[model samples]
Target: MPKGKRTRIVALTRTRKKGLDSKKKLMDDLRSCLEDYERVFVFSVRDMRNAKLKDMRTKWRTSRFFFGKNKVMAIALGRTAEEEQADGLHKLSKALRGQCGLMFTNSAKDDVVDFFGKYVEADYARAGAVATDDVALEEGPLPDFPHSVEPYLRLKLGLKTTLNRGVVTLLKPHIVCRKGERMTPEQTRLLKLMNHPMAEFRVNLVAVWSKDGVVERLNPDADGEEDEEEEGSGAEDDAEDMDSD
Candidate 1:
C-alpha cells in the first residue's frame, strides 16, 4: 500500500474510535436520564417550511427540536439494531431515521404516554379526523386498532382541522401539546405542578390519584333520599297565605 494511503487509513481509524467514544458518552448520558426521569416523549415531524420555521421561532420563543442521527443514537443507547428489534426499542430507532425528535422528562410515565398519544391525536384531528380512539386506549402511545381505522380516519379528516388558537383538543387537558405554537405562559407554568404526587383525575366526581388511591363516584340508584315529613311549626293558614303571595 502507498505510504500516503496507509497514513489516511490510520487517521480514519482514529477518527472512528473518537466517534465511538463520544457516542458511548452520549449513551451513558441517556441511560442516566432514564434512571432520573420517569418518562420520555418521542415525536415524528416533517421538515418545516422556512416561513413556518420562522413563525415557530417567534411563536414558541423556545428551543428548536433536535434531530439526532439514528446511528449515533443507537450507539448512545448501547443497543445493536438486532437487539433493538428483539427488545422493541427499534420503533424509536426507526422514528429517529425520519423527521423525528424526542422530549425527555421525569414526570409520570403514564402521564408522558398519555401526553404523546393525545399530542398525535390532536395533530391528526387538526387534519380533520372526526373522532380519536383515545377513549379506549390504555397503555402505549402507539395502538393497534382495526386496520380500517387509523390513516383512513386521519385522511378523511384532512388538514385545516386546526383551531384558531392552535390548541388541539384532546380527550384530556394535561396531555395537550401544541406544535409550532406557543403555549400560553399559564399553560407552561401549570405543567410544572401537573405531575404532582397528590394530583388526581376525576371522571365525573370520582377522584383517581397518581400513586394508589381511589374514590368512587356516586350512584343515584344506590342512595335514596328520606321522605319523612317534619312536624310543621308554622300555621297551615300562614303557609297557605305565603304560597298564595
Candidate 2:
C-alpha cells in the first residue's frame, strides 16, 4: 500500500493528566479578583447547605464566592511569599486548608463582617452531623403525627410507638438524639420528621487580605480546623456544583 493511502490506528496509553484546564481558569479568575476587588476574605462553613449558599450568592450578586477545591484556591492565592499573587495573599491562602472558601468583594469591611456575623440559617441535621441538643419524645399521644405514620415510626425508625384512637402514641419515652453526639441516619430522619432543626449553617470569616497589602487575621483560632478532604465525607459535593456559576 502507498504511504499516502495507508490507514493509521492510534494507540491508547495511560498517562497521568496534569494541570486541569478548569483549575487553570480558576487560578486566573482568582488572580483577576485579587486585582479587581478591594478586599478578599477567607471564610469557613459549618454544616454547609446549598440553598443557603445560593441565597447568599443572590444577595451579594456583585461579590464573588469560591467554595471547595481548596488546593487550587490556595495555589491561586500563592502559597509562599515569592509566588504570591499579591502582598499578604500567602497568609490568606494558609486559611484555605479547611472546609473554607474565598470571598472577593468591593463592599465595605464593616458591612461584610456584620452581614456574615449575623447570617445564620438553621437546617435539619444530616447523617454524621453532631446533635446540638437533646431531642426526646414523651411517653404519650403524639398528636402531631398522623396514625398512618405509626408503622413507619415503629418498624422503620425503630421507635416504640403504637396507634391509639387514630393517633400515634409513644409507648415509652424515646430519645431521638443527644447533645454533642454524632447523629445516625435514622436519628436525623426522625428529627426531620419531627420538624426539628439541629444544624446551624454559618459562615465565619477566618482572615482577610486588602489591596493595600494589609492582612488581618479575624479568626486566628481556626488555624487547626480539619480539612474535609481528609475525612472523605463528600459533604460539600452539592456546594461544589453550585460553584459552577
Candidate 3:
C-alpha cells in the first residue's frame, strides 16, 4: 500500500554546531591524522548541504574529511593552514582561503578526482544562489497541490490562480523566474510549490597534494564565483569542490 505524508522522508532543518571543546578536539584529531595519511586534498565548500555531505562522507568511508575553521585546520597541519600546510603540503592550505576542508586518504588521486567530477547533484536553491535555468508555472491544474493553498500563492506570488474542482489552476502561464538572476524569496516559494529544481551543486577540485610529495592545482582556471555556463573573472571564484578521501 502507498504511504501517507506522515511516512514521507524529511530533511534535517538545523545542524549541530561545534562548541569550544569540540573545535579543539577536531584540530587535535586532524593534527594527529596528518602524519598517518599519505595524500591530502584541499577542497572548498559553498552552499553546503549538510545531509548531502553526510551521505558523501559515508560513501567515502575509507577516507577522512575535516571541515572547520581554515586557520585551525591549517595550524593542525603545520605552522600555517592558510599560507602553507606542511613541507610537502606547501600552498595546500592556501586553497583554504574560503569555506574549506581537508581530505586525507590513501586512495588513488585519479580515482578520487574522477569521482568528484562526476558527482554533481541538483540542490534546492537558497538565497543568493544563481539560477541555473528558467523556472515557470504553466497555465494548468496543479494536480498535486491541495485546494487550500490557492490563496497564499495568489496573494504572495501575484500568481493568477483559481480553485477548480478542489484543485488550484493557473489562469495563464507566467514566468515565475528567469535564468541569470539572483533567486528571490517569492520565486523560491513558487519553486517549492511547483516542485522545480533550479540549482546544481558540484565539487570543483582546485588543488591537490599527492602522496609522492607532489602538489598541483587541479582546476586552476575554475571560476568559483561563475557557473559552468557563465564567463567571469577568476579572482571572485570563492566557490567549492568539497570533501572525500
Candidate 4:
C-alpha cells in the first residue's frame, strides 16, 4: 500500500521571563554610573509628566537618570555600608523609599541644584485634582463654543445651554468648579475645552551623594526610610496615566 503523508506535531515552549535580566542590567548600569559620575542625586517628582521629563533629560544630556523599582535601585546602591559600591551610597539609597529616581551627573552641584529648583512646568489639571481657582461661566452667549456642542455642554457637563441664532448660549450662570474642591471628570473636561491649565510639574531633590563619602539631606520631610522588602512601594517610572492631562 502507498504510504500517506505524515503530520508533524510541534511542541510549544514558554517564553523565558526577562525580569531578572532587566534588574541585573539596571544594577550593572548603576554601578557603572557610580564609577563615571561625580555625584548621585535622589529626586522626587510632583505631577510627573513623561514629556517634560524627556525634555529635561535632553537639557541635561550629560547626566544619566535611572528610574526603577525602589528596592532594586536600593540594592544596586547597596542597603548597607558593607555592600555599598561607593561611600555614602547606602545613605543616599535610604532616601529612595517612595516615588523617586536617581540622577548621576558630573555637572556642578550648584548648577544642577539651581536648574531643578527653577524648573517648573504648568499643565492642565485632571479629574480628582484640587481646583486651583474658581471657574465660572456667566449667563450669556458662548460664542467661543460651536452650536453643535450645546447639547454636550447641556447634557454631559450639566450646564444650562441653548442655541440662539446658530450660536451656543448659556441660559444661566454655571459654576464649573470651586477653588480647593476636588475636580470632577466633567469639570476637568470643561476646563480642557476652555483651555485652562492648573497643574504644575516640578522635581524636588531629596538627597545628594558625593564621591567624598558625604551625603547631604536636602528634603528631610520627604518619604521616610522603608524596608527593602516592603510591598506596593515600588518607585514607578511614570506617574499615573489618569493623572496626566
lDDT of 1 by residue, 1-245 (tens): 55664454345445322345544554555555544443333443322232332333343232222224445554444354465412334434433333333334545545544543343111112222222221221222222233333343234422112222333322322332334444433333323222211112111111111212121222213211222131121212221222221
Sliding window of 10 residues with minimal summed lDDT for model 2: 231-240
My TM-score estimates for the predictions, one after another, are 0.28, 0.83, 0.75, 0.82
Each model's number of backbone clashes?
4, 0, 5, 0
- Candidate 3 lDDT, tens digit per residue, 137-211? 779998877888899989988889999889899999988777888878888877877777676666667788765
Listing every candidate in turn, what is its Cα RMSD in Å to the true structure after a full C-alpha superposition? 28.2, 6.7, 10.9, 6.6
Q: Give lDDT per model, in order.
A: 0.32, 0.81, 0.68, 0.81
Instruction: Check candidate 2 and list the clashing pairs.
Output: none
Off by over 4 Å in 4: 1-18, 224-245
Off by over 4 Å in 2: 1-19, 227-240, 243-245
Better model by TM-score: candidate 1 vs candidate 4: 4
Model 1: what TM-score? 0.28
lDDT of candidate model 4 versus the reference: 0.81
lDDT of 4 by residue, 1-245 (tens): 76657855656785554468767877887899899999999988777577777777878878888767788888999999998998888998888876678899999888988998899999888889999999999999988898888899999999999999999899899999999999999999999888888899888899999999999998877553445465214333232211123
How many clashing residue pairs, candidate 3? 5
Question: Lowest-scoring 10 consecutive residues by lDDT in candidate 4?
Answer: 235-244
